[model samples]
Target: MNCPLISLKAGAVIFTVLWTAWMMWWSGAYSTANLVILAVCGAAVGYVWYRAMRWQFERMGMLPHKDDRSAQ
Candidate 1:
């Protein structure tokens, strides 16, 4: 619940679907280009989600490290 990564992942999925639907509707047709854009968006979202998860884990003292072991 405290992890932002989960929320971000959900957002990515929700937005990707919405964006893809909007784009598809606007174009009035589907094509390879649209699929490529969708892929790019998904990838970008995935990257952001990964970074956010790392940051959140670090902030929450959930990241693993020898030094961290002493702190806890």
Candidate 2:
């Protein structure tokens, strides 16, 4: 149950990081600045998605309950 969701999340995180790196290199020029910028942007999006998914799951009672809002 939860394992599938956890696995999906893990897959998404790794996929985002790897895809960002690959896309950076695949586009040619190989600029460090470009890679860094894109990586940071990708990371931010991934984090937002992760948080949103977790929040929804928590609301649905699919995840353990906790007062995580104050931490944010």
Candidate 3:
């Protein structure tokens, strides 16, 4: 199977942005402190999610091998 076109960095960024936006909208009352906390938490969650998915995909051979220089 072809590897997914999205890179880890891109996936994390996309996830974080979407997550933060969704949370902000859901909360309905925004504050500077809330925005900052949401952004930071979103990024951290996104990174962790990316790593977990990457590991699973690699194990399943759905992602490029780490040592494959031409994979990227």
> Number of backbone collisions per candidate, in order?
0, 0, 0
Off by over 4 Å in 3: 1-6, 64-72
User: What TM-score would you give candidate 1 relative to the actual structure?
Assistant: 0.49
lDDT of 3 by residue, 1-72 (tens): 243736766887898899989999999879999999899999898988899888888788877667774655
User: TM per model?
Assistant: 0.49, 0.60, 0.75
Candidate 2 regions with alpha-carbon error over 4 angstroms: 1-9, 18-29, 67-72
- Local distance difference test, per candidate? 0.66, 0.75, 0.82
Give the per-residue lDDT digits (tens) of candidate 1, residues 1-72.
334546656776776677666666777756788778866876676567667766677777676544665787
Please state the error at residue 19 of candidate 2 in Å: 5.0
lDDT winner among the candidates?
Answer: 3
- Candidate 3, position 17, lDDT: 92
Name the best candidate (by TM-score): 3
lDDT of 2 at 68: 49
